[model samples]
Target: MNRFDTDLIIAGGGLAGATLALALARVVPSLRVTVVETFPLSADALPEHYQPSYDARSTALAWGSRLIFEELGLWPRLSEHATPIRQIHVSDRGHFGATRLNAGDHGQEALGYVADNRWMGLCLMRELLETGVQWQAPAEVVDMTPETEGVRVALKRGTETWSLSAQCLVVADGGRSGLREALGFQTRNHSYGQNALIANVSTGESHRFTAFERFTDAGPMALLPHGTTTRAGHQSALVWTLTDEALDEVLALSDPQKCQRLQERFGWRLGRFTRIGECSHYPLKLTTVDEAVRPGVALVGNAAHALHPVAGQGFNLALRGLMTLVEQLRQAVEQGQSLGDLQVLGRYQRLHRQDWQQTVQFSDSLIRIFGDAPAPVAAARDAGLVGLDLLPGAKRWFARKAMGLGGRRAVISKPGVARREPAGHE
Candidate 1:
């Protein structure tokens, strides 16, 4: 085994891991940090079909996440491919629409933006160059053993094995975290028994920079606008949840058939949903670990909790968790990374309860409220939305929470991120 040394060793290079690396670079510049990513980087952009159709399952970035990206200077690169979500229309199926949210309510341009994950992934890699962090892709942590002094991780790359010892470790290795499991953390999972049907399409009429969330018997059918000027014409990404049985039927349809089927469900709302790219299916569920903290190691992101996509916050909270940990570690650097001991872990636990649990509970409640076909449940939820419109204070709180600004530390939205006109447009 080859011996390696670093102040911190982060396993997994997905959004959570990447965020942790960048946050550390910014907040604790002198700390030695290295990321071990399983997925190797590729030079090719994989020419995608973006004609009238593109299968882009985009993310609805909250103000907080946007702020994080901006502070890290990753926003400029990603802004080119992202579109702002101006207005949000929320209602139950058919004429009984209950509540709608306008950015004017919050004195903001839009609640968030929608951008493709793959595009953002590339932007992350581009931003890393300036972050000055070391990364090992196509790598894995085969074994990890912890001692009072620190933690040691055995990394594997093909046939080579390297042993890395660090004073602190971050576990962001996704829902099925080997380290978390081995360290005695157990997760409680709740499944919605529904899958999200995602795709991108052209709109007949302009989307007017509006995003929509329409709850139905099956689940929510959301439309997030991609208001990009370089990409002329109105475009929107779809996240349509379906019953397990309906999911099978939708997934079985051919690409062309899917576009038509989606148009039928949407009723020409976006100009007949003319085209589609690759249709992907993912089941919705919640995986939360009650014990996410231990000595020398603390889990972040999906490793700590994996939530449903109804609110598109699964990754957002992960980003927030990493950011919080970075801030805590950065400030307590005199105490060293591992010195973030149990007390520091307590801080992380507290923030997780406030920031992440909110989204998980909100999304879970939505899945339960909308997933049920029972008449009483539907009626009750409808009334809830109706009541929300009448309750301004409640709506304001809801908007603030959704924007990821409710946390005590403003975990995700740190107030420094300012809106800038995206390139290729203004």
Candidate 2:
């Protein structure tokens, strides 16, 4: 008889958790998997059709992410609502340093793509419903205890409580993960002392599938091409960084006044800002856990590391880590080793640690170099930008890093691996 209730139990079912579940279902169907989530999910709850909204939240998927999804057979549906980033424009406000990277110059169709968060969740949920993975929604892991060979978790659903054991437990709740704290994981946080104002705006001219990253003395701002153009005009998702005081002042202004302020800071690169939608803001911080793995347990996604949104590298990095974990787990199954073996999990961490460190440093450096640099440093930064634009090899290197192709790529698929029925539960 099987000793555990499930081979793997994943806490939380948001983007990161859901994506990991779907990836595992595709790569290792033989392993029994169960996902515990706070929010309820059902076929009846999902929308049959997706309608794009101006204020809808979105995520940027780097080019490498596209390859990962294609391997799982999800890109076909996801691309339906995705807007390709054909070019990227990086510049410093009030300075002549600016660089433009074209997808054609890099021998690719697009550097990345942006898709609505709701629509992406819809795609992931739909695919997950058809898989063999079990679901426990409107439920959560109240607490967990590590054992010799596995972990035991107490789950609470509505008024009822139950216990289950799993050989491996994956905590992917979110940035503010309660499970992570309950597990006693230590973390380091560096606050940027800035808040990001997010909204969707329409301009007088088309975006031409271009994304803009403009840095100012206050902070950095990004404009990603949103969905298709409407009679309202071209649209783009705005992520404007501001001090706490500035954010309050801007949020209190009328729409037209807000547009004027934005125009002053962003210039007429996309022509005049005609309309702005509802606005939301969140504080920016760099949060990282001391260790991502322990015997019989692991953390993925935001639970492991939360980065600044200006760089748009958080989700892409998480996707890479989860895929690497899946690869290592696949090897464990083939070698007849315990899924929760420290050696197995450590190898996964060791293989992915370099990418994790490099990405965090890259994102952090961008903010520090431009946030409040001295005059001499500012001039050097500007000169560096100009040199990056002028040199072909340097441009390629920068472009690859931005597109998430600089690190070691994870192997997400193997041909001729047939699906097998999961082991029986006690």
Query: For this target, which candidate reaches the highest TM-score against the unseen true structure?
Result: 2
Candidate 2's displacement at residue 411, Å, is 0.8
lDDT by residue for model 1 (144-169), tens: 78766677878899999978887777
Q: Which residue pairs in model 2 clash with each other?
A: none
User: Each candidate: what lDDT?
Assistant: 0.72, 0.89
Query: Which portions of model 1 miss their true places by more than 4 Å?
Result: 1-4, 42-53, 176-179, 182-184, 227-232, 336-340, 373-377, 409-426
Off by over 4 Å in 2: 229-233, 415-426
Q: Candidate 2 lDDT, tens digit per residue, 1-426?
A: 999999999999989989989998998888899999999876765887778878899999998888888888899999988899989999999989999999999778889999999988899998998999999998999888888789898999889999999999999999899989999999899999999999999899889999999999889999999986222238999999999999999999999999999999999999999999999999999999878899999999999999998778999999989989998998898898878889999988888889889999999999988878889999999999999999999998888888888776677655475533211100
Best by lDDT: 2
TM-score for candidate 1, residues paired by index: 0.87
- Cα deviation at 350, candidate 1, in Å, is 2.2
